[model samples]
Target chain A: MMHRIDAEALAYSYTSGQRVLDDVSTHVATGEVTGIIGPNGAGKSTLLQLLCGLLSPESGNVLLNKSPLEQYTDRERARLVAYMPQSVSPAFSLTVREVVALGRFPHLGPFGSLGTPDHEIVQDCLGQTETSHLATRDFLSLSGGERQRVLLASVLAQEPQLLLLDEPTSSLDLPHEAAFFRQLRTLSGRGLGIVVVTHDINMAAQFCDRLVLLGKDHRLVNQGGPSEVLQADILTDAYGSPLLVGEHPQTGGPFVTAPVGGI
Target chain B: MTLGNTRFLLLLGLVSCAVIFTCSIFIGTETLDLGQAWRELRSLTPLSEAPTLSILLMQRIPRTLAAFLAGGGLAVAGCAFQALLRNPLATPYTLGVASAGALGAWVAFLLADVTAAIPLLALLTSKQVMAFLFAGLDVFLVYLLAARRIHTSPAVLLLAGVTLGMLANAGIMFSRYLARPDRLVNMDRWLMGGVDVLGYQPVLLLAVGVIPCAAVLLLQAARYDQFAFGTTLAAGRGVNIGRLQTTTFFVGSLITAVIVSEVGPIGFVGLIIPHGVRLLTGPSHRLLMPLSIVAGGAFLCACDIVARRILPGETPIGIITTMVGGPVFLYLLVRRRFSDWNV
Candidate 1:
């Protein structure tokens, strides 16, 4: 199958002169979990935004299945890709089910009245995210992990072909993070193209099909399999102080950890 | 409450409000029994013998109906504005729409005869045209102040609205200053707001306008649900954010403007009723919109009743609403501090 996303020389900047993403280009294959890793302010989120068509590029364009992203209407683009932000705090206290059902907006008409299909999709998404019990709970009242799950459920309800998650597990504990990634793995296995932006190199190495390393100048320094991308020099260069990379004994995936540099 | 229980309670509240409305007609200064009131209502008895029935049917009934319609319209408008702006503090008054409408009404009141003589070009040629122009101008000002380089923030929108309201109030004071001393009473009474001054014609007009608009708003409830997630998410989910915002604001402002034109500027019925309904029925606009309308009707009817019988003559309904709504709102704020409600 052709790649879901093909970007060529994509660049973006917040202001007129300051470039946040500089001449970055990459491709995301079908059914692959592509992880984007970079230090803080490395423009990972900006790149994700560019890919999702949330921000138009200053230089190049992103192609969704060969067609330019800009050519698609907002609804059509939404049906093709689901982009989840790093953290979303709702201004009002919507119930978990109400929030999840919002994903059906694209499918509904101008009024967005839900039919049986919308309700079914909402139910499926809630069950898939293990938030069926929390459906009636207030979204604002949920813990960070639970909120993440509910938000994920909302995105899943969109049922998009490409899933873009910006730091999905940023607020989760180790166990929850592992479980979350496990769910992502299951999703990718179902032939959904997933692109997750994260700073957790070890988690990326374990779950991702490929890793795209980003640098401060909004450039892609390397892109390859986890074994090639998670090298000690690459880690140190990317993070400024990363120490070690080793293979996990059970999974045989690369495990990266930062050592205390000089006391 | 369970969803079923909430629906049940809402229905019960509606029935109770209707019953209270009927009872309100019977218990005035000159008390009439329900039978006499019914006979007068049926036109079987002369109104002169039953003064209370006459008052209830002719004066208080129309006033109460007007109060109900205006209150419901304002409250539902507030709910739409609050959701559209994503600010809890957003209301028709806070957004300057009420003040704009007041300015429009004031202009109409001041230049009752001159409106027909003014040419289109000359109409735009003076500061007196400011009041007539302020209604549309205030909306533009709100849009300009709220919008930043990227998009509008709800907090900024709220602040902009407050600023516009203050400016309109200043204009009101200036208009009052220019008027003769004899005219001050009319200005003061209109500024204070009352449903009693309205008759069946305006009430009928309000009913004609509000019922259809309310239905349209109710139909768009699901869009509001999508919007509650955030603008980006809503947009990403295929909601035309700009279109939705424009439609909601236009409809909401129209409802508010009509009500303000008919009555004076009633306060807080919009702000309090919607929030109160949201507290009972969760924040689903599907439920919130309809419930706000019903609750608003009940609340305003109750308030109008209190305004009428609380003293010798009827006090302004606006005073009663604020007097009751302010304390209730404060109580909710205080209770939220100790409770699990996160809104």
Candidate 2:
């Protein structure tokens, strides 16, 4: 079954009273991949966090399955909307398996002993993320790429219907970053709604079914399919730069590049 | 969370704690052999000529139990505070809560004779009420200054806490200097923490303070373990971050205050025992927390024995814990290096 989350005309500002996001609205549905793409200080991260109930918009409300997001308890919302942070600092030397098992907390009883089925799910997530070999290793000792994968596995253990990620591959090399997006595509194939915030516009154009382009003013510039939203004029206007859009010679897909000033 | 290894480790800890507890009860200034203890237990007379029975009933059991409960309480409080503060060096007193509580207790002793008209205040006594209030004041100030914002630097927290702690300690010293000559010895004894208590009052005092608070902490052990991943990530897993942090600070500080009022402000048990137990049990709080309690109890019991035997007169157990734990803490730091501490 498909699940949906909608945001009405949302606006938000930080505690310092600086307006960061304004009049933004979007919807994400299962079996589809959406990307929130923008330049620095565009509040893409803030918008994604609002969608996942991490931050409440000052003016608008988020709806999950036609009910207000705030109406649901934290555990209820968490069981459906799983969020993966950009980076994490492990306070203790927990094993990869232990870190993954924590995702089952919303499902566990008050006593919180992970039963065999919970362990099995954790093991499956590790296998799904291809980190099974590192399950017994220390989470803190892993390299940046490996740590992101492990953290992704931990988020997957939540069995969420809607997965919201904030720069999930920001630290990866090219191959690993592509691999991470491909993994997301596979998960979306299994009827999951995935929303990601990233700086890589061309990568989003290649992977996401829909693009929510945020402009320099932190407002929604455009929202539609990649072919409609990834035009040269919209790209340049959103990024405050002269970005040239063209076809990838290899894949015959949308390829975007920004012209450096000296060039 | 695997039961196999955890069960074995727990059983081993329990056995060691029990053995050491028995030895602690038996080894003291007046030694009673096992056979004599057995005979005393078998004796028919209630209080006649049974030195073993009197010593066991009057001295050893109470003293040992006091050490056990205080050590257990301090260790659990330390674990909770460390998790909340995200700093491994944090103890029950790191945020200055217990120091303020101790200073309140010292003043309460000076003002013991004053009668209060309020029934509730009179019932709980000035020392306990003052200790709790001052501990609360310390948390309020520390939270306002250092932890009101979650992302405050660790160096700021350390500086704020240690500076406030020094001020409270100075208050204690100033009061000590102005005190009458007759009160000097009493002030000196309390300044150095000890379990040289006699009778069941200390044990009862520690149990009253430690049991419920420790239970609250143990119940939140799994939640605290999730805190290792930091607040934002932990909250992503459905943890109510606000509730957890509030409970940890208040409950941990209250327990620290209770011990401070009862047996003076003992240190190092809170600072080092949890870290030592973490080495054995890894970082899972389910294992690290309870095991620290058992290990801490056994450790302090043993320390009491050493304190009794180290010199002709019993040195304060606080001196022994610092003497012993200081070296161990240094060794741990030297081996682990500054790289391990993100703060």
> Top model by DockQ, which number?
2
Instruction: Give model 2's clash tally.
Output: 1
Prediction RMSDs, each to the true structure: 4.4, 2.5
The most accurate candidate by TM-score is: 2
TM-score of chain A of each: 0.96, 0.98
Using Cα atoms, each model's DockQ against the true complex is: 0.42, 0.54
Candidate 1 wrong stretches, greater than 4 Å = A1-3, A15-17, A92-95, A109-120, A133-137, A231-263, B1-3, B20-62, B107-115, B119-163, B197-201, B204-216, B333-343
Model 1, position B257: C-alpha lDDT score: 72
> How well is each residue in B310-333 modelled by candidate 1, as lDDT tens digits?
665868877887787777656754
Q: Cα lDDT for residue B294, model 2?
A: 95
Docking class of 2: medium
Show the lowest summed lDDT stretch of 10 residues, model 2 chain B.
B333-342
Q: Name the 10 consecutive residues with the lowest summed lDDT in model 2 chain A.
A: A254-263
Alpha carbon lDDT of residue B119, candidate 1? 71
